[model samples]
Target chain A: MITPSPALPIAVPLVAAAFLAGLRKFLRRWLADLIATATAAANLWLCTALLRASWHSNIVYWFGNWFPRGRMVVGIGFEVDPVGAGLATLACLLTLLGFIYSWRITDSGRDLFQPLMLIFMAAMCGFAMTADLFNLFVFFELMSTAAFALCGLKTHEPAPLQGAFNFAVTNTVGAFLILTGIALVYAVTGALNMAQIGFLLGSRHDLLVIAAAAFLCSGFLIKAAIAPFHFWLPDAHSVAPTPVCVLFSGLMVELGAFAVLRMTSVMFGQSLLQPHSAFRATLLLLGSLTVVWGGLMCFAEHHLKRVLAFSTISHGGAMLLGVAIGTPAAITGWLTYLFAHAMAKAGLFFTAGILLHRLQSMSEPQLFKRGRPLRFTAVLWLLGGIALAALPPFGLSNGEDLIESATHAHAIHLWVTLMFFFTSAMTGAAVFRVGMRVFFGLGDAGPADRAAKIDEAPDGPEEQHHIPARMFLPAALCIALSAAPAYIPGFGRWFFNAAHRFLAQSLYIARIYAQPVHYVLPPAPHSDLGSTLMHGAIAVVCALLLASWAVFHLALPRGFRGATHLEGPMFPLRKLQSGHPGDYVVWCMVGFVLLGGCLFLLP
Target chain B: MNQIVHIFPYLVAGWVFLCGLYGIATSRHLVHTVISLAVVQTSTYVLLLNIGFRTGGAAPVFADISPGITTVDPIVQALMLTDVVVEATVMALLLAMVVKAYEKAGTLSPDDLRLMRG
Candidate 1:
C-alpha cells in the first residue's frame, strides 16, 4: 500500500471546497449539503488515519522534496507529531459534528455556508500541521477570513454585521502582530521553520528575541481570548450561527492555546522555562483573571448565548492555567479539558439553539418554562452543566484532577485551587440557573407557570414531538464522547504518552534536525481516585453554594444588601468593550505595547 | 549617514503605525476606522521592505542585469505582496459590512450602535 502524503488532510478539503464554491450556484440544496457532509466525514476519517500513522513518530513531509540541504531548511514542511495530530483530529471531529448539526439549517445563503465551512476546516488543518511560521500566519488569515464571512452570513441582522466587523478588525491587528513578529524572528535567525529557529536561538536571551516573543504571544493571546484581549469573543460567539459558535468556542480557541504553547516551547523554551520567568507568571496571572471575570459575568449575563460565551472564556482560562503550569500532568489536563469543554459547550449551545429556534429571543427571563416538558433536552442540559462544573461522569473531572495535582506539585497550591473552585462555581451556577429557569422552571417569584408570551407557545405536546433528530444527534454524540475520560480506562494513559512527547522540546528538535526514530515513552498513566475525589468534594461545595441561589432562593439577588453596586468593578470593563471596532483596535495596540514592555522586563 | 539611513525607515514605520492606532482610537466614522486600518497595514509594508533592503541593490530579477550586481531579497517582497492582498480583502469586507450596517441602523457612529450590553 502506498503511504498517503501528509498534505492530504489539508488538500482534500481545499479541493472539495473549490468544487463546492463552483457547485453552490448550480446544485440543489440537499446535493450540496450531501457533498459537504460526506467531505467532512471523510476528513474526520483522514485525520484519525494520520493520527494513527504518526502515533509512533513524527511525520515530516517536505514540499516539492525540499528537505534540508546539510544544515539549511530549503522549503516548507508539514510536521505532524502526536500532539499536532491529536489537535488536527480534534479540529476535524468538531467540524464534522458542526456539519451534522447544520444539516437542518436551510437559510438563504446555505450554499455559501458549506464552502466557507470547508475552507475553514482546511485552514484549521493547515494551521495545526504546518512547521513554517509564515505559513502558519497565512493559514491563520485564511481561517479568520472564512470565519469572518461565516459570522456575517446572516446579513439581514444588524448585530451579526456589527459583530463580524469588530471581529475582523481585532483579528486583523492580531495577524499583523504575528507577521511582524515572524519577520523579526527571521531577521534574527534567518530561518522561518520553527524547529530551526528554536535550534538557532537555543537558550539565548536577546532583547530582540524577547520582543519577538512578546509580539508573537500577544497575537495568539488575543486569538485565544485571554482577558483584557477577550472583548471580541462574546460578541462574535453570541451573534455567529449556532454551528459556527460551536467551532469558535470548541475548536478554534483551543487551537489558539495550542499555538501559544507551540510558539513558546519551540521558539524560547530553552531560555524561559524557569520558575521566576516573567512569561510564565504573566500567563498565570492573566489566566486567573480571565477565570474570575468570565465566571462572574456568566452569572450576570441575561442572554443565553452570551452566557455560554462567557463560559467559553472561563474554560479558556482553565486551559491557560494548565498551560502556564507547563507540567506533563497540567498539559494532559489541558488537552483533556479541551475535549470535555468542546463537547459540553457544544451540547449546551445545541440545546440553547433549539430554544432560540422555538422562541425567537435568547433572553433567559423570556425563555422561562418555554422549554417545559422537554425532558430529554433538560436532562442533557443538567448533565452538561454538571460536567462543565467538573462534578462527575465526564473527563472534565479527570482534567480538573490533573490540573489541581499539577498546581500542588508546582507548589502554587492554595491560590490556584481557590481560584479554580471560584471560577468553576460561578460559570456552573450560571448554567444551572438556565437549567432552573428555562428547562425546569423552578425559580419564579410567584407560582405562575401559565402561558406568558404569545410569540412563543407553551411547550405543548406538539413541541416535544417536533424536536429534530439531527439537532439532538450531534449533542448526544458530543456528550457521549466528552464522557470518554471517565469510562475509557486507557484515556489517561494515551494522554500521558502524548503529553510526554509534546512537552519534550528536544524530541521535536531532534525529529526535525536528526530524525531520531526511536524514543522512550512516559510511564503509563492511571487514574487517581484521591485527586478525583478531592475535585468532587470541591465541586460539591460549589454546587451547594449554587443550590442556595438557584434552588432554595437563599441569598436572593434582589434581597442582598448593596445589590445595585454588585457589578461595580465589572461595569468599567464592560464599558471598555463598547461594541465599537475603533475601541477594539485601540485595545489591541495597547495590548501590543504592554506585551513588549512586560517581556522586555522579564525577571 | 549610514546610521541615519538604517534608522529612518524604522522610525517612519513606527510613526505611521502609531498614527494609525491613534486614528482608530479617535475616529467617529467606520470609514475613518477602515482607512486607519489601511494605514496600519502600510506600516507593515515599510517594515518588510526595510528589512529586505541592501544598499545599492537592484531589483531581484536578473534576467537582463549584468553579473556580480547585488539584488535585494525577493522573499520579503513576496511576503509584502501577500500582506497587501490580505489587507485589501479585509478592507473591502469591512467596507461592505459598514455599508450594510449603515443601511440597517441609519447611522455610522459607534455610539449609536448600542443594542447589546453586559
Candidate 2:
C-alpha cells in the first residue's frame, strides 16, 4: 500500500541538483557521482514502488488539496496511471544505470555533471507524471536545458560543443512551438488539466485546435528526431560522452514519441480514430521516409557512434509507424519496440564506449586496424546488434510479426510494413559490415597507432582497463531484458495493455466529441487530393532529375576532393563558435516571428 | 459594459505580449533575450489574472478583515505566482550561463563562436 506522492521524485532530484551546484568547490569530482547516483537510485526505488501500487490501484495527488469549484478546477494535480507509472519506473532505472556507466570518467567537471543529471531525471519524471499543460511545458524546459548542459560537458572538444549547440537551437524552436500550442489551446478551452480539457472540448472541432495539435506534434517530432527534423540527432548522439549518448539516443528521443502519444490521446483522440481518415496518412508517410532515410544514412557512415545514431532514428520511425497504424496490435508493437530498442541501444552504446576507451578512437578503419582483445565486448556488441536488427529470438522480431500480421490487409499498411522490414535488414547488414571490419580485418597498427597501446611492464599481467563490473552488470541486465519477451509468456502484455488503454481512452473521447470540434481542424481533409498529386510529381522529378545529377557529380574524383574540402571548412561550423549576440538575437527573433505568425494566422 | 471590461485586459495582455516578442526577436544581447522571455512570461501572467478577475473582485490574500467583495480567482493567482517564480529562476540561470560563456569565449556574439561542425 504505497501512497503515491507526486513531489518525491521531482523534488528530491531538484533539491539535490541545487545543493550539488553549491557544493561544487568543496566536494569536487566525487560529489557529482555520489549525488547523481544517490538521487537516481532513490528515484528508481520510488518509481518501482509506485509501479507496484499502481498495478492494483491509482494514485492522485492534488496541490494544496484544492478541489474543483463549479467546474473550474484551481488546484494543480498529478495522476499516476499504470502506464505513466511503468514508464516513470523504467526511465528512472535506465537513468541510474547511465549514471553508473559514467562513474569512471573524471575528465569532465563533476560538479556540473551531477546537478545536470539530477535535473534531467527530475525533468523526465515531471514530464511523465504532470497532468497540467503549463506544468508540462516547465518540465519540458528543465529537461531540454539540462540536456543542453550535459551534451556540452566536454567543452574543449569541437564535436561535442557543436553537437550541443545544434541540439539546443533545434529543440528550443520545438519547445517554443509547444508553448505556442499550449497558449492556443488554453485560449480555446480555458482549462489546463488534460482530462478536463478533453471533457470540455469533447464534441468540438476547430482550426485553433488543429493548429495547436500541429504545433505540439511538430515540437515532439523534432525532439524525437523523426526524419526531416532529424538532422541534429546523429551529431549530438555521436559527440556526447558515451553514457550521455546512451541516454540521449535511447531515452530522450523516446520521450518525444511518448509526448506525441500523450497529447494526441488526451486532446485529439476522437479525430485520430475516424473510420475514414485523420492524421494517420501524414504519420505513415513521415514514418516510412524516416525508416528509409536512416537506413541509407547508416550505410554511408564510417563512425561507429554515428551509425548507432542513424540506427536509432530508423528504429524510432518504425515505432512511430506502429503507433500510426493505431490498431491494438500496432500499439502492442509500439510498446514492445520501445522497451526492446531502449535496452539494445543502451547496451550497444556501452560496448562502444568500452571500445573507445580501450582503443582511443571511434573511427571504424582505425578500430579495425587495432583489433580489440576483449572478446566479451565483441560478444555483447554482436548480441546487441542482432537484437537491434530484429533477428529471430529478439523481442523486436516478435513485435514486428504482430504488427505485420495485423496490418497486412491494407495496402498502405503492407507497404509500411515492408519498408520497415527492409530497413531492418539494411541496418543488420550495416552492423555486420562494421563488426566484420573490427573483428576479422587485417590488424595493421599504423605509425601513429603506438598511442593506442596500453603500457604494461614486462612479465606483468595486462592491466584490465576494461568496463567496470558495475557497468558490465547493467549492460548484461539490459541484454537479458531484450531477450525476455521471447521466453516469458505474456510478459509484454503489461506495458502493451497500458498503451492500448491509453489509446482506447483517447479514441473513446474523440469519438464522443468529433462533431463540435469546429475550430481546430487539420490541414485540409485527407492526403488523397492536391497534396498527393504534388508529392507524386516531386518524387518522380527527384528520381529522374536530381538523383542522376547527384550521382554524376559525386562520381568524379575531383568532386570527392572538392566536397571534402568544402566539408572541411564546414567542420568548424559544427562547434556553434559564433560569439555574436546579434546573430543569436536574429535567429531567436526569426524563430519567434515564424512561430507566432503560424499560431495567429493558421486558423 | 461587463463584457467590455472583461475583454479589455485580454487585449492589453495580448498587445504587451506581441511587443515583448518583438523586443526578444530584435534585441542583440544575451540580457535582452532574458528580458524578452520575461516579458512573454508576463503576458501569460496577465492573461491568468484577467481570467480570474471578477467585476469587483477582492484581493485573494487572507487577512483579519471579513470577506467583503468577491474574492478574485485565487487559483489563477496562485498559478501565476508559481509561474513568476519559475520565470525568475530561468532568467537567473540563463544570465549565469551567459556570464560563464563570456568568461571562457571572450565575446557574446553567437555568430563568432564557431568551434564545432559536422
Candidate 3:
C-alpha cells in the first residue's frame, strides 16, 4: 500500500469543496452530499494513516519540497504528530457525522451547505497540522469565514443574521490579534515556523515575547470562548442549525484550546514555562471563571440549544485547565476529554435536533410533556447526560481521572477538582432537567425567560411524526463510541507517550532540522481510578439532586421554594449578554485589555 | 529624531487599532461597524509592512540588484498581501449579513437588534 502524505487530509477536502462549489449549479443535491461525505471519509483515513506514521516520530512535510537552507526554514511545513493528526481526524469524523445527520434536511441554500462544510473541514484539518504561523492564520480565517456563512444559512429570520454577524466580527478581530502577535514574533525571530521560532527564541523572556504571548493567547482564547470574551458563542450556537452547531461546539471551539497549547509549547516554551510565570495563573483564573459562568448559565437557560452551548463553554474551560497545567499527563487527559466531549456534545445536540424536528421547538417549556413518544431518544439523551457528567465507566470520567491525578501535586489541585466537579454537575443537571421535563413529563412547567422566547427556525424541510432512522443512528453511535476509548485496554499508556512528545519542544526542533536526538519515553502515569470514581459518583449524585430541585422545587414549603429560585440572582449576569454586537465588542476589548495587562504588567 | 522616526509607525499602528475598536464599541449602524472592522484590519497591514521596512533598502527584487544587496523583507510583504485579501473577504461577508439583517428587521441600529437578549 502507498503511504498517504500529510497534505492529503487538507488537499482532498479543499479540492472537493471547490469542486462542489464550482459545479453547484449543475450538481444534484444528493450528488453534492455524496462528494462531501466521501471527501470527509478520505480525509479521516489519511489523517489516521498520518497519526499512525507519526506515533513515534513527528512527521514534517514541506510544501513545494522546499527544504530548509542549513538552519533556516524557508518553506511552510505540516508537522504531523499524533495529537495534531488525531485532532484533524476528529474534525473530519465530526464533519462526516454532521453530513450524515444533515442528509435529510433540505438545506436553505440547496448546494451551499455541503461545500461550506467541506471548506470548514479542510480548514480545520489545515489548522491542526500546520507548523507555519502565517499559514495557521490563513486557515483560521478560512475556518471562520466558512463558519460565519454557515451560521447565517437560515436566512428567513433576522436572528441567524445577527448571530452570524456577531460571530464574524468578534472572531475576525481575534484573528487580527493573532496576526499582530505573529508579526511581533516574526520581527523578533525572523521566522514563522513554530519550531524555528522556538529555536531562535530559546530562553528569551523579553517584552516582545511577553506581548506576543498575550496577543496570541488573547486571540485563541476568544476563539476558545473563554469568559469575558465568550459573549458571542451562545448567540451564535443557539441560532445556527443543529448540524452546524455540532461542528461549532464539537471541534472548532476546542481547536482554540489546542492552538493555545501548541503555540505555548512550541514557540514560548522556555519563557512561559519558567517558574513564577503569571501567564499560567492567568489562564487558570480565566478557566475557572469560564467554568463557573458557563455552568451557571447552562443550568439557568431554558433553550435546549443555548443550554448545550453554555455547557460547551464550561467544558471548554475544563480543557483549558488541562492545557494550562502544561504536563504530559494533563494534555493526555485533555485529548481524551476532548474526544469524549466532542462525541457526547454532538450526541446531545443531535437529540436537541430530534426534539426540534418532532416538537417544532427547542424550549423546555414549549416542548414539555410533548416528547413522551421518543422513548429511545430519551434513553440516549439520559446516557449523554451521564457521560457528560464524567460518571464512572464513561470516557470523560477516565479523562478527569488523568487530569486530577496529574494536578495532585499542584498548589491549586483542590480548586481544579472543585471546578471540574461543579462544571460536570451543573451542565449535567441542565441536561437531565431538560430530559425529564421534555421526555418524561416529570417536572413542573419550566421557568419562562426572554432567552426561551427567542425565535428559532427548525431543521429539515418539514416536521415528521415518526423519527427517522438516519437521525437515530448518528446520535446512538456517538453516545456509544464516546465510552469506547475508556474501555480500550492500554489506550491511556499509549496516549501518554504521544502527549509527552507533543510537549517536547526540543524534540520538535530537532525533527524540523532533520537531526535525530536521543529521546526517552517516561513511564506512563497511573490514573487514580478509585478517587476518580468517587468524585464521579458525587458529581452524578449532585446532578440528580440539582435536576430534582429544578423540577420539584415548587412542591417544597413556600419559604424553601422561594429560596430555591436561582434565576433571579442570575439576571444581572445575563444582562451582560445583551446580544448587541457593540456590547460584545466592548467585552472583547475589556478581555483583551485585562489579558494584555495581566500578561505584560506582571513581574 | 532617528529613534522617533523608527518608532512612529508602530505608534500609529497601535493608535489605529484602538481607534477602530472604539468605533466598533460606539457604532450605531451596522455599516459603520463593518467599516470599523475594516479599520482594525488595516492596522495589521501597517504593522506587518512596517516590520518589513528597512531604511534605504531596495525592494526585495533581484532583476537589477546585486545578490548580496540589502533589501526589505519579502516574507512580511507576502503575509500582508494575504492578510489584506482575508480582511476584504471578511468585510464582504459582514456586509452581506448586514444587508440581510436590514431587510429582515428593517433596522440597522445595534440597540434594535436585541431579539437575542437574555
Candidate 4:
C-alpha cells in the first residue's frame, strides 16, 4: 500500500505562488489563469491522494526529519489525520472552482489575483494540517492577509476599500491577540507543538492557562464572526468580488470555528464536558443569538449579496450550535452543514454574479427588467436556496435532522434548535422574496442595453463569445457533488466517522467525565388550592383588560399609522457613521483595548 | 538589577509597539499606515527574540564540534526569520494596494474617499 506524503499539498502551492509572483510581470493575459488553474489542479490531485491514503493510514511528517533526535522532539511537524485531509481536499476543490469561476473576469488585475489566491489556498491547507501552534498562527495570518487584499482588489470602489480596511483592522487585532496568547502559552509550557502542549498542560489548570485560553478563544471567535465581531463580515462579503465573496463567506470564515474546535479538543477537552458546563452554555448562548441576529439582518437586506452574506453568518451560527452540543451526532451535523453550506453558498454567489453580469445591477428590483434572461439563473438560485433552507433530499436536510435529534431532549438545546429552524425559515422567505421580485415584477425595457452592459465589441468575434464555459462548469460540478453525498451511504459515513473521531478520540472530554454523578434536589408536590374561584375571577379580569387595551390602542389613528410618523428618530444611530479614517482607527483601538482588558481582567 | 535587566527588553518592545500604534492612530496617509504596520511587526520580532534570549547564551550559529555548548534558542529565531519574510510580503502587498488606490482616487488622504457609503 502506497501512503501519501503530507507535505506535498502545502509545498506545491507555496512554491507555485512564489513562482507566479515572480513571473507575473512578464506573463500574458491568459498566463495567470493557466498558472492558477494548474496549481489548484495539482493541489487537488495531492489532496485526493492524501484522502485515499488517510482512509487506511494516518500520515505524519516531521519537519527537517528531526523527530528522533535524542528523544527531544524539538522539531515542528505536520499531522494529516482523516479530518484534516478531508477539509484540505474540500478547500483545494473549492479553490479550483473559484479559479475557474473567475476565468472570464478580466476586470480584476489577473497578475495580482492568481498568486494571492494560490497563497490563500496554501495557507488554508497549512492551517488544516499543521501540528504546531505557531505554524497555525502563521497560516492564519497568511490566509487573513490574502483575504484582506482580495477584498480590496477593487480598490477604487469605496465600499470594497472601506470593507477591506475594517477587515484588516479587526483581523490584525485578532492576530495580535492570538500571538499574545501563544506567547503566554509558550512562556508557561515551553512547547510549540499542539499535542505536546496538551500533554504538558494536562490537569494543571492555572490563572495563566485560563487567561491564555480565553485570549486564544476570543481571537478565534472574532475570526468566526460569532455575533458582535460579525459587523465587518457583511460589508466585506458584499463589497468583494462575487467569487471571492463566495469563498470568504462559505469557507474562509468557517476556518475560525474549525480553529476553536481543534484548540479546544487539544487543550481543554476534558474540562468542557463537566455537568452544567459554563463554557458549553456560553457557546450555546452566542450561537443562538448569532443565528437570530443574522437571520433578522438577512431579512432586512435588499442587496442580493448582503442577503447571502448574512445567511452565511446564520448558518455558521447553526454549525456552532451543533459544536456546542458536544455529541458525535452533533459533530457529524456540523461537518455535514459545513460541506453543504460551502457548495450551496458558492453556487448561489456564482448565479448571482451571472445575473448581475447580464442585468448590470445587483438590486432585487432591477433583476426584473425584460432584457435579462432569468430562466437558468433563477432556477440555479432556487436550487441553491432550497439546499440552504435545509429542504429534504439535500445534504443540509440530513444535517439538520441530526441536529434536531441531538438537541430535542434538553430544554435549552430545544430552544436553540427552534432558533435554527426559525432562522432557516426566514432565510427561505428572503430568498423567495428576491426570486419573486426578479421573475414577476414590472418589466423595465427602455432600450437595447446589451451594448452598454456587455464588454464584447461588435467586430471582435473572439471577445463576443466571452461567457467562457469554464466559469459555470465548476459551479455546476459543485452543486452536483453537494447533492451526491446524501445518496451515497459510505461517503456521508466517511465524514461522519471523521467527525466522530474528532469528538471521541484521544484527549476528548468524554473520556474524563464518562462517569455519571448523582445530584440530590429538594422535591416539590403539586397542589390545586382554590383553583375554581381564582380561575373564574382571573378570566373575567383578563377579558376586561384585553377589551380596554384594544379599544384604546388598536382603534386609534396612531395605531393605524403603525409608528410611521416617528421615522426620523427610528434610526438616529446612522449619524454615527462618520466615514472618517481617524474615527475608524479610534473605534478599532477602543474595541481592542476593551476586549483585551476584559480577557485578562475577567474571572 | 537582575530583575531590571530581565524586564528591560520587554519594556523596549512595548514602547516600540505603542509608538507604532500611535503612528497608526494619527496617520492620515496610506503610506504612513503601512509604515506603522511595519513598525508594529518589528516590535513583535523584537519581543520574540528577547523572550528567546538567555543571559549568557551565545549566538545560534554553529562554530565548533561541541554539540551541547551554550547556544541561543534557534527555534524562536527561525520562527522570527520566517515572520519577517511574511511581514515583508504583506507590506509589499499593502503598498501595492495603496498605489492602486491612489491611481484610482487621485489622493492618498483617506478622509476624502467616500464612494462606498451606505
- The candidate that achieves the highest TM-score relative to the unseen native structure: 3
Task: Kindly list the per-residue Cα lDDT of model 1 for residues A1-603, writing each as its tens digit.
Answer: 344677988889999899989877898878888888889888888888878877777788899989887668888898887788887788788788777777746373567888888889888888988888888999998899898988888777677887888888888888878887887888788888898888898898888788788878888888898776787887787778888888899888788788989888877788666655788787888888889888776665667778788889988987898899888888888888888888888888887766765656566667778778678888888777777877766778788778877766456777677766776677777777778778777755211111111122111223334667888898888878888888877788778777777877777777776566567875754558776767766775675456345444534656662322322324445556577777777777776676677777767
User: Higher-DockQ candidate among 2 and 3?
Assistant: 3
By lDDT: ranked, best first:
3, 1, 4, 2
Pick the DockQ winner.
Answer: 3
For candidate 4, report its TM-score. Answer: 0.81
Which regions of candidate 3 fall more than 4 Å away from where they truly are? A562-564, A568-570
Q: Provide the lowest-lDDT 10-residue window in model 1 chain A.
A: A449-458
Summarize candidate 4's per-residue lDDT along A1-603 as a digit string, tens digits. Answer: 566578888889888888888987888758778888899998998988887776643466787875724323477787676677878888888888888877746365447788878888888888988878999999999998999888887654545666676577666656766776786677677788776676667756566776577668767777888765566676677667776777787788888888888887776665434434555666776788778777766655556777788888888888888877867667777787788888888888887776666555665544554323556666777677666666655566666666666665677765865766755665665565566557544222111111112121111123222345665676667666667656776655676667765654352322222223232222211112233123323322432332233223334566453222211123232233334444444554554454445444534
Q: How accurate is candidate 2 locally (lDDT)?
A: 0.65
- Local error of candidate 1 at A15, Å? 1.7
- Number of the top candidate by lDDT? 3
What class would a CAPRI assessor give candidate 1's docking?
A: acceptable
Q: Quote model 2's TM-score.
A: 0.76
TM-score of 1: 0.94
Clashing pairs in 4: none
Model 2 lDDT tens row, A1-603:
566486798898889889988877887566667778888999898988877775533466777887555556566777666667767777787888887877746356445776887888888888887777778878888888788778767654444554565566556656656765676677678788776677677756667677677777777887887876676677567667777777787788988888887777776666444442456666776788779878766544557787788889888888888867877666666777777788888888887777776666666656774544677877887788677767645667666655665576777766865766655665665565556557655322111211112111111123246556776777777877886766777655665556555665543333222222222211211112232233323323332232223223345566443323211323332233232232343444443444335434433
Q: Which order, best to worst by DockQ?
A: 3, 1, 4, 2
Poorly placed runs, candidate 1 (over 4 Å): A1-3, A106-108, A445-465, A524-527, A547-572, B65-68
